[model samples]
Every structure is written in structure tokens, then in C-alpha cells.
Target chain A: MSNTPLLSTRGLTCRFGGLTAVDRVDFDVRPGQVHAILGPNGAGKSTLINLLSGELRPSEGEIHYRQHPIHGLPAHRVARLGIGRSHQKTNIFPRLSCLENCRLAARIHLGGVIASWRSRAAARQVDERAEQALATCLLTHRASTPASAMSYGEQRQLQIAMVLATAPTLMLLDEPLAGMGREETSRVTGLLRALRDDYTLVLIEHDMDSVFALAEQITVMVDGRVLETGTTAAIRGSEKVRDVYLGRHQQEQA
Target chain B: MLHRYPKRVPIIMLALTVLLVFYPLWGPVLIGDGSDFFLEKLTLMLILGLFAMSLDLLVGVVGLVSLGHALFFGLAGYTLALASPSYSAASLWWMMPLVMLVSALAALVIGALVLRTRGIFFIMTTLAFGQMLYYLVSDASFTGGSDGVFIMFKPTLAIGELTLIDLESPLQFFYFVMGMTLLTYLFLHWLIRSYFGQVLDGIHDNEHRMQALGYATYGYKLAAFVISGVLAGVAGMLAAMQYGFANPAQLGWHLSGEVLMMVILGGMGTLFGPLLGAFAYELLHYAFEHLTLYWQLLMGLTIILIVLVLPKGLAGLILDPPRLRLPRVGVGGLLRPRPAASTKARLGLAGHHKHEEG
Candidate 1:
């Protein structure tokens, strides 16, 4: 992987009223690496993902993708710039079929203008891309099923599939394994591992085992601020990270 | 596209089309008395159906419920009245396009401002703009104030030596309106099944998801608004031509509310539903008017009953019939305990059940 960050943020901050959801934070994800963001609840990991995905504007900071500043851009514009994100809430179109959910994400590359009166079936490229994404996420069998009809695990897979369909160069996933059962978690971890070689991933996850298994680099956040950033080995051995995060976990386990 | 509809819906739609096609021929004989009056009423219903269907494109498909949709309808009618010369008929070829353009421009401007807000705020803003126009025409001297203006002559469609459509004749005008309604239906049918329509459906289902998927939803909504406005304008122009007059009432929120009611009464998302709604609403309105002085009360009760019985509206009766099931209210049912699972799971299963039925 290249040393140059595919997406990098300097002094990124987001404050909601008096509460600083995400304090001034400097973070980066290099190309083709699974960079995991680990934090406890309310540590502003999701907020950081929201800022990077352009879902929320930062109160103070600069976000650069490929060395060009992209702060203050709308989510749609940010997505167009090859960054995609999945929500912690599994935000797929529940009423639409799985294929349609992927097709919508895939069709963005077809341009925004309403120039055609032909049937959606005629847009073979969009359908193919959608199908391909479903295949990649192992959701091809559920293509015709409505998203709401799918199991929670399958829905999570559909979420990643949707991001995949966008053909994004960089992906920001928030809690992809948030509520998955053990089987679903491993399945999604497999999917993420498969995706690692093809696209850069910024993952915010509570599951440390998957984070350690899949992520080459890790960033831990505590109270909306980055606690530390290092390789998996360094973070696993870091004194500060253990004292604040992992130590607490070990104590609870004991 | 055809496969998406219920089996009975397509057959029923075909039967309806056949009935409409033959209505102008046999309708007069069936009614026997006041054939001309009935014909005019039917024509007006068709025009209003077009208007209601246009609004459905916004409310049902794009998920925008504009309370001032009548603005385009009235504005176009006024355009027709003002553009017509006192002694001569306006050219249909030029005037129709001009009126539609005017409505489109108004929609573009209004859509830009109101689209920034969503839900109830959007509705209120649209209603405010509509009311503003209503007062402008009501109080402005050039627009004939509250008195309104008359199109002295009907628009004419003519070639070098041939006249194709003469809107002055009731029968010809009726056929013209029927043709326009069919065209709009077909156009919308094609549009809603297209890639553009899929995007609209996506927006309606989950706009935030669509935005995250990289769609500039504002532009799509604006386009739908303009298209809907242009269609409503066509209906408005036809109404003005038929009545030979334009008034502030046409632009009022009352008219907008009526059209919205028609959409809800028929079925929101289905294009054919609004047309069905228009015919049903107008026919009921005509029937109730003759039956009692408090027709509005009866009408309100009927609407409430329909809403309670067929929540999806009149179109839903055919497209998606509600399952009839007896309520479990006997002693055994009352004694039984409710499921202890989370309500979310129950709701999800209930949604799935409904989806299967539909």
C-alpha cells in the first residue's frame, strides 16, 4: 500500500450545541487497507464517520481525499468523489428489493439528468453492476427479496453490497457488525476481508476481535478524541490504549 | 412493468378505458335528458383528473405534498384568458406551449424555494405561494380583480387550409380532453417504470439513502415538480377553455385541497388511482348535490368511511384488496395473552405479511 493517505483529515471537529461530539481529530486511511476505528459507546466514532462521509459538516477542520480538500461538501457530492458509507442503523430501502437497493447505488455513475423514458430494465449496465455487487457480498440469492424481508445479518450484508455497488475507491463503514450474531459477524468479516484488497476501508467497530483480525492499522478513540494510532501490533501492546479501553474490557471480563 | 400490478387491475383498467372510449357515443342516450350538461360535466371531470394525476406525481411518487398545486392550474387558465384577443380566438399551437412554459417557470421558482424544506413546512410554503397568487389575481386591476377575466373565444387548431380541432364544440372538446388524459396517463406510465421513475421511487422510499447513494435529490424533485406543473397547466388551460373564463377560485388552496383529496381517495402512488378518484369524487359530488342541501356533510362522511374501509383509497380496492378477517374478540381471545416478543419483531412480521398479500 502507498504511504500517501487516500483520505486524510486534519483538526476535524464536530460539535452539537454545547456537546463536542467529535473533538479536533487528525486521522487518515491509506489506499487498500482496512483501517479500523475502535471506541466505546458515545466516543464519537460514528460522528467521525459522519464527518468523513460528509453527512455532517465539521465545526472546525479540513478533510482531504486524494490530497484535495473536500470539507463542507454535501453527502451526495462526497459520495460522488469515490467515498461511500454504511450507517450503524442498517439504512437500506426496506420496501425495495435487494437488487433495486444495489441498483440505485450503482446507477449514480449513469449521471443525474432525467434524459430517458426507457424502462429500468433497459439500463443493463446498472443491473449488471447491482448483480455483481450482490454476488460479491454473497447476497445474489436474495436479489429479488425485499430488504425488510431479509434477516438482520442479510440486511447488513446488503448494506455492504450497496456500498460495493457504488464502486467507491474509499469506504467508511460504521459498525458493520454492531448487532450481528456470531455467525453473521464472521460472515461479514469474511466479506470485509475479501473487500480489503480491492478498496480502502475505514471501519468504526465495537468488535475488537474482527478489528484485530482484518485491520492492518488501528485508531482508538476515547471521549471524542483519538487516543492513539498505530499498527495492530503496536495498538495491542500500547500502554495508554489498554489503560483507557482494553484494560477496562479485561477488568470486566475478570 | 405490467407484472407489478394485480391481475384484476389491468383487466379493470382495460374495461374502464373501453367504457370511457364509448362514453361520448352512448352516454347521451343513457342519460336521455340534459345530455349536453352531463357531457360537459364528464369533460370537466377528465380535466380535473389530469390535474389530480399531476399532483400525484409529486405527492405519491416524489413524496412532496404541495398545498398550492392549484397555482399552476389557475396561472395557466389566466394565461389562456389574457392571451386571447377579445374578438378572435388564440392559436392553440402557440398559446398552449406559452401557457405550459409560464406554469413551468412558476413551478421552477416555487419548487426551488419550497424544496429546501420538507414535509409540513413544504406544504405550508407551497400553500403560501398559492395564496399569494390568489390574492394577486383577486386584488390586481389588470387581472380583473376578484371578478376574473373571460376568454372571449376558444383556441383553434388550424393548418393552412384545414382546421383540425375546434374547442368551441362540446363533443369535440370532450374527445380532445379524453385524448389528452389518455396521453398523460400513458406518458406517466412509461415515466414511472423508467430509470427516472425508479430514482423517484427510491427517493420516496428513503431520500436520505438516495442522497447517500450520490443522487442530488433536489434536482430530481425539481424536475418532477416542473413536469407535474406543466401537466396541471394543460388541465387548467382546458378547463378555462371549456368554461370560457378564469377566476381566483381556480388558484385557491380550496382547489388544491380538493385535488389532494382526490389523490388520497383514489390511491396515492398509482397514476390510474387519481383518475378513478376524480371520476368517483365528481360523480359522488354531483349525486350528493341533487340529493341534499348539506351535501358537503354527506360527502365528508362518505370520504371518512372510504378512508376507514379502504385506507389505500378507491384504486386500492382493485390493485390491493384488504383481507377480510374477523376480529378475535370472544371470551377465549380476550383471555389469551399477547406475544411477549419485542414490538419491533412483531411489526416487522406484520410488514412482511402485508407485503406478501400485496
Candidate 2:
């Protein structure tokens, strides 16, 4: 919070007619920090991430990144300014090979359309970045396999690799652990831990154990409202958080 | 470096090219002696192939099914007809460049408006634009209205006193179309292989994801549209010069649908598929008409049968034949149905193998 925040929002709000999906939420993520947004169903975590990522513009309030206002910019422009987002579902080019998927992501950051007219291999840097990201996600062996041919877990990992290939300074990941076996969950959890060293991360997940283990700062939400933003230990110990979001999930787990 | 080398691709392309380049000369012997009709249809097939290739650029590669593609192609033909000796006596030099420029600019304008919408809306907008052009041309007196326009004298290519390839003779013109088609193919082939091509493919696969990855999806789609439109225009220009006429039929919705059918029938994503699709469709149309007046009904049935049987287009069958493996017989004897338990055990092993693949 002391060092210039990578991304910050003030009173950001989104409404769906009668329902306010995101209700004037306020939070800031510092550089290289793992920030988790925890909430029960309908707490509007995805909506908040969408609003911040410029997929949906805020009806009210401001979002600043690198000390510049960016609430109204288009999603692509927001990404170019270094905020890459992974969807809640594993979203990737299904027909394209896993390496090609990551390569496409890297190519957008590397010169885009102008560089597109040359053979993809000619851009050595793009390949290296794609390979590096693939390796990080443990998808190197499946690099030549079509994304459609991949398992649910592999596709999920490939989605993260895609985000990483873009070389974003910050990544907004929505449910990175959503539909995974125990081993897959542990693999992704480890991948997230390593990723936090270089890029600021804002993760939205329902997994309490990974959230507690990885998050430096945790923001607990209830019914589209940010109830508290505190350290992992503080949020875990807070009576209010325990009674609201974690209590419900912990009981379900038990 | 990332693309794997295919050993047979170059050889196949070379054989197809050589056969096409010499078709007019030697084709008569194979079909029947002195059949100008065969040459004419084959030439038309090549031009339609080019048109379909351009559309496939949008439909297959970019996932935009543009219904306005004929507008660019027909407009180029219209411009050439008016510029030629029948109207203003404009030379081919100035006439061709001016018309191509006009068509490209028109594509840019239409692409800007159309690329804004998506899905059925985008398809509808393109259809509207194509119909608008068709109506404007058919209703206008300068365009000869419903009567259409003709090119009396084929434009000659010359630099000062030195003459290059003349556009008058059918043989020369066929060669011109061939050369243009080849150039278009080579250029597009290079483009699809490029990084830009990959991005366009990505956009088709998942536009939202590409945008999230920092791609200006709209801009790339528009550029692709214009490129496709320009290529279609070039094909239209060739068609006009070949037939010595430009009519409302060139710009009509039927033409748009015909080319779309060609792209789908050939294969959507691959470059050569459109060419093969155009040839097959044209040949079938010719053959059916010769057989009976109910050619339309027959053609429709054939297309349905093809879809049912092939599933993939004509090119897809040749290029990537679907695997059809039969069950292996046991060493002890020929295969036969086993008892319940053994049947289940055998099926389980096969199921396990399929599961690993899946």
C-alpha cells in the first residue's frame, strides 16, 4: 500500500437495472502482491474484475493504473497498458495448438498486425516468451496439441500460460483453480506462487486453502460490497469475515 | 520455424498449378477436340475460385461471413466496363489502377461500417451493403441500368511503344487470369502463414480472449475484410475482361450466396479449398444443365448428399481424410461376437485407449 499502487479503484460501481452488480467497491493492489477477493455466491467478484479490466465500464467512480485514470478505456487498450485477465472459465482458441495459443498472445504484445505478415517463427522473441510461459504452466509437452484435445485441467493451465505470454505487469485471474483435481489444484497453486514474484496478481477464487496460503492481502466481499480488506491473518481472524463469507464456505467444506 | 514441414504440399501445389496453366492448350484433347466451351467454363471456374478464396479469408480464417463480397468484385467490373472503349476509351493502364483503387477504397468504407457488428448482425449488414450496390448499378443509366455494359475492345498492355501481354485473345486472357490467380494465391498463402494470419485465426477462435490479451480485434478484422474485398475486386476485374461485359448479376445477392457456397463446399479454412470448391460447383452445374432442365433440383440434392457423406468439403477429403479403422481379428480365429463377460472386457480395453486419446 505504501509503494505506488499498480492498480487502484475508488467507488467503482456497476448496475444491472434493479440490481447493482458491483456496489462502489474500493481497493488497491501494490506491485508484486497476491491479492485474493473472497466472497460467497453473488458477491460480484467477477463483475468487479470485469469493471476493472474495462470489459464493462463503471457506471460511477474512477479506476487508476500506474497513476493514470483508465476506467473508460476499451478492454484491449487496458490490456496494452499491462493488465491481462484470465476468464473464470478456461477460455482459449480450441482449434489452435497450445503453443499457437500462447504465441498469438505473445504476438499481440510483440508488434501485432505488422509482425503478423511474417512467418511466426521469424519472431524468435515471441516463441521464447510463449515457450517460457508454457513451461511455467507445465504445458510444454502439450504445446503442439490442439487446445480442444486437452483435458479440462490442461486447458485451464493453458489459459494461465496465455495470460503470462502477454507479459502483463499485472494479471486479473478469475477462478484459476475452478474445476481441477487435487493434484491439478496443487500444481496451479504452486504456479500462482511463483508468478507473484514478478507480476501483481488479483485472484478471484472460492478455494479457501489456496487463498489463505497464497494471498498476502485478502478482500472479503458480501452481496456486492467489500466488507473488509486486510492481511490474510487479520481477515482469517476477523469475527465479521468469519461470520459472513468464510464461515459459510468452511461449514460447506466440513 | 514453428510450422511443421509438410513434404507432399509443395509437390501437390506444383502439379495443380502446372495443370491449370496449360489447360487451355491441352485440355481439348482430354475432353473433346475443339471445344471452346470447356475452356470458357474452366476460366470462369478459376475466376470464381479467386472470388471464393477472398471470401474464405473472412469466412474461414476470420470467422466473418460477409454477404457483401460481390459488391467489391462487381464494382470493379462496372468501373472497367465504363472506362473501356465502349464508353470513355480509357486505356488499360489508367483504367485498371483507377478502378482497383476505387474498389479498395469502397471496401475500406464498407468494412468500417460492417466490422462494428458481429454474428448475424454483421452478416445482415454485409448483405444490405451488397444489395445497395446492386440496386444502385442496376438502376443507374451510366451503368446501362438493367441492360448492363460491355467492353468492345480488350485493353492492351504497353509501356510507350513496347507491347507486353495483350488482353484481347482468349488464350492471352486466360494466361492473365492464371497469372493473377497464382499471384493472389501466393500473396494470400504468405499472409495466412504470417503472424498476422495467426492473430486473425485467433480472433475467429475467441475474439474476447484476444482482446483481453491486448489485440485490437476490430482493427484486425477490418484490415482482413479490406484485404479480402480488394482481392475479390481483382477477381471481378478479370471476370469482366474475360467476358467483355459487366452486369447486375456480378453484384447480385445470388452471386454473394454462390461464392459463400463455394467457400463452404470447398473447405473453409484452407486456401486451396475454395479453388477446388469453385471448380466442383461449376462443373456440376455445367454437367447437370447438360443432362436435364431440372438441374437446380439435382444440384441441391448433390450438395446435400455431399454434406451427408463427406461432411468435410471436397478439398478436405483429399487433404485430411477421416480415419475409419476396422476392429482387429483375434489370432486364434476370425472375429466374432463373444459371450457377455469377454465382450465387455474387450470393449473396456478399446474404451480405455479412446479415453487416453480424448
The prediction achieving the highest lDDT against the true structure is 1
Least accurate 10 contiguous residues by lDDT in model 1 chain B: B349-358
Measured by TM-score, the strongest candidate is 1
State in Å the error of residue B1, model 1: 13
Per-prediction tally of clashes: 0, 2
Per-residue lDDT over B55-166 for candidate 1, one digit per residue giving the tens place of the 0 to 100 score? 9999888889989999999999999999889998889999999999999999999989999999999999999999999999999998999989988989898886588977
Q: For each candidate, what is chain B's TM-score?
A: 0.90, 0.87
Worst 10-residue stretch by lDDT in candidate 2 chain B?
B1-10
DockQ for each of the predicted structures, in order? 0.49, 0.50
Q: CA lDDT of A37 in candidate 1?
A: 93
Measured against the true chain A, the candidates' chain A TM-scores are 0.95, 0.96
User: For candidate 1, lDDT tens digit of each residue in A1-254?
Assistant: 57899999999999999999999899988998889998778899989998898889999999999999999999999999999989887777666789988988888865443322344553677788889999999998999987877887998899999999998999999899988999999999999999998999999887888999999999999899999999999999999999999988777779
Screening candidate 2 with a backbone cut-off below 3 angstroms (N, C-alpha, C), the clashing residue pairs are A116-B195, A116-B196
N/CA/C clash count, model 1: 0
Per-residue error (Å), model 1, residue A143? 2.7
After aligning candidate 2 to the native by TM-score, how far in Å is the CA of A198 from where it should be? 1.9
